[model samples]
Target: MMQATTAVRGRTERAGGKRAEWTGGLSRRSFPAGFVFGTAASAYQVEGMALKDGRGPNICDAFVKIPGEIANNATADVTVDEYHRYKEDVNIMKSMGFDAYRFSISAGTGKVNWKGVAYYNRFINYMVKIGITPYANLYHYDLPVALEVQYGGLLNRKVVEAFADYADFCFKTFGDRVKNWFSFNEPRVVAALGYDDGRFAPGRCTKCKAGNSATEPYIVAHHLILSHAAAVKRYRQKYQHTQKGRIGILLDFVWYEGLTNSTADQAAAQRSRDFHIGWFLHPIIYGEYPKTLQVIVKERLPKFTPDEVHMDMLQSVIPQLKIQNMICKLVVFLIVRIMNFLIPLASPGAADERNGVLIGNRANSDWLYIVPWGLYKAVTYVKEKYGNPTMFLSENGMDDPGNVTITQGVHDTTRVAYYRSYITKLKEAIDDGANCIGYFAWSLLDNFEWKLGYTSRFGLVYVDFRTLRRYPKMSAHWFRDVVTSKN
Candidate 1:
């Protein structure tokens, strides 16, 4: 969890203040030249043409239909209508002086929705025409519903191949113009919220069946990793020379700290890191899961065949007792086993390191703590452990309750502070030799926030779902200054 300071809270409290007044004193520091600063949105979250443009049905399209699945019975049927209004949206980006526009695309195996391809091509062209580099994400939780129905979405290995095919299509279609590519956005959310908690689309499992073989989040994550790797391999082999772009995975991670200095709390904090960020990151960087995770999965997850182990070593390598190691290893293993039974909290944190706390609490709320320091630590950890591959702050923002109203304009001072604190930390990381190249705020505007739906708003711009109006919040001005000032 990212810390909400008085500055941030004060901004949120003045949700109706004049945008200029609120943004007047915010100073922006100069960032490295060509350092990208942009806002992001996804197809399912903002685009309303769910069925148009020959767009195949996505998991989100189907999942929202399930009773009690979405809040206020709201579906992203008309979201911000970005599909039809992308040109206008690009104008908005250009007017805001945005150098890059990051958006997600809808693509699946043989189910290549050519209409979607055409739509994205036009969108890409518009961004290029407007002089904004387009950063396209292949998937952002909007898995094609057809794939989910035929195969269990990310749980099945077949989905990995399908996603690769989709990536190949994207690379071939838009690679000439678009350079930056994200294989998946916040995949851990897909595995944990969609597969394990069943709170989001394709809601299948819940806490009651928590840790069940059928509900293994790690399995879903395993396939997602394979899918990401396959896309990267495809891009490197086929598109790199012609496209002149780089490929990387975007992970949502935060800083975690022990609630106290007790050994039990420290172990719990480490476990939180292992389960949240390490689950997806280890494979991408280390080519495997953390050793701690392997032990937990072995104890709690179902068994797999030798062939499965060979093919999917990333997720299937649950630790076995036969391996001989130091006494410390055994002690750590026992401690984790005990913690698993005693503590049931795990969540990702904000991208910006504020205090030194982990953020999300998909399971239990008490265990979630905001540790801004952890953001710095997490970057250092990735740099040290993953050999410092090109990295960026993929997703980072403050979540606010939506009922709060802005009489004048959307204040969102909390979000502004969140941005400042995180960006400040990000600068420190870059100064420390972390090769971070870009920063994409978690969202451009508030749209469907998965299970939280219209309840949690993390957007710099406010979206009035009823009227489909887009209003830039106070944070938007803050971010605009940051971008214009190159801070």
Candidate 2:
């Protein structure tokens, strides 16, 4: 466990003679020896050149053009131009004493266009040359427009093969030096917001339009799980001997607080848990879908033929029903009941376990959140349920308005507070026996924030989209101190 220190307090005097006292929470002691500190950025979010260097168009490129898709009518066409300025980005990371740097590949869906291959090669090589471990992610919500045009992205099983091929390309190309690999970034957001909520790219599908009546998202998730497993299998069989690396999936979760201690609210919170976090984590760690998902799929979701199943499953007996049209309904109900009995228990005490953390978005926006303590709870939950493998923060940060300006610099005190509170919880999680190996801040610079475009800022360093100048915010300096002091 990292030691704790006194919170730092300071005062700032503005040019207008207004004075403000800044008091931060307890400063964490230096991170345990060899603890990793890093920053993250995604393709499409930070890598501009949406149409340059033979880069094929991704869904984001098209999604942003739709009227009212992005908040500020901004596109990532020239976002920091990381495609051309990766060396500079590496310099920024090095200057901040970052030990690891993670970035997402923008290969449209599964096709690895030469331009993406070259761009990622440059970025990974630059990180290697600078002595920073490069942790690369296969997908970060930038599905290829071609795939969506052909088969509605994850809704089609062909995407699983395509994504596996893309992962193979990445492992073959960069696996020599870049060993740490993430299959996807916050797939829950993709499942809920994109397919179920209809707020994100590949906008509202039939499932969300039908509200809970449609089961496309679960089916899509089925495909995604197969894709991830295929990628992991490929990495293990082919790349592990040479790279000697590990592969894992990245997921986002929040701590659920029952509205009250009543059994009904507790049950509701438990359902939320199985629906949200367990949806993704269960399959990857336990080799099966969450029970709640199985129930929902069987009871409320639409069904596909045997051809629709992404992976092979054990054959089950189906009894003939007496009613003519009720056959499908009866079959589904039986399947749901069978699943309720057959789905493996998550753990002995998972349902009753509560980490005493409250998760809520800091800002009212869908992207921003203030669930600092949830970080700890998530780690502990994973530890208890999945057997604590060497884990990383994967994603953590708050979003701010990108249009703000400051003379002294980009003073994001709110972001600083967010990081401080989250880090403190992270420290507590580590002390509680979660094998948290590292931390990765969500983003490196302000860029196109998917559907929100440049409306939200989540970067430790600020990027001037007009001038393409990178300026470190107050959080950047604070992070530098944290890294330098090994906290």
Predicted model with the maximum TM-score:
2
Model 1 scores a TM of 0.79
Model 2 whole-model lDDT (C-alpha atoms): 0.64
What is the per-residue lDDT of model 2 for residues 14-61, given as tens digits with 9 covering 90 to 100? Answer: 321321122133332535667778888888787778777777887768
Q: Could you tell me every candidate's TM-score relative to the true structure?
A: 0.79, 0.80
lDDT of each: 0.64, 0.64
**What's the CA error at residue 287 for candidate 2, in Å?**
2.2
Model 2 misses residue 472 by how many Å? 0.6
lDDT per residue for candidate 1 within 1-487, as digits (tens), equals 0122224435543774654344443333435656777777788888887766577787788878877767777788777888887887777676566678778887655656677777888899989988988988888888877777786677787986788788998899899998888788888777877777676656656554333324467678778877776776677668877777766666766445555567875677677767777777765545556777777666554343454445433333222101211000000000011121123323333232214432432111122233345467777766776566566665665666666664323756556665666667767877898767667776777777766678767677676767766776767656665566521
Give the poorly placed runs of model 2, Cα more than 4 Å off: 1-29, 108-112, 207-213, 299-361, 364-367
Model 1 stretches with alpha carbons more than 4 Å out: 1-29, 109-111, 206-215, 299-371, 406-409
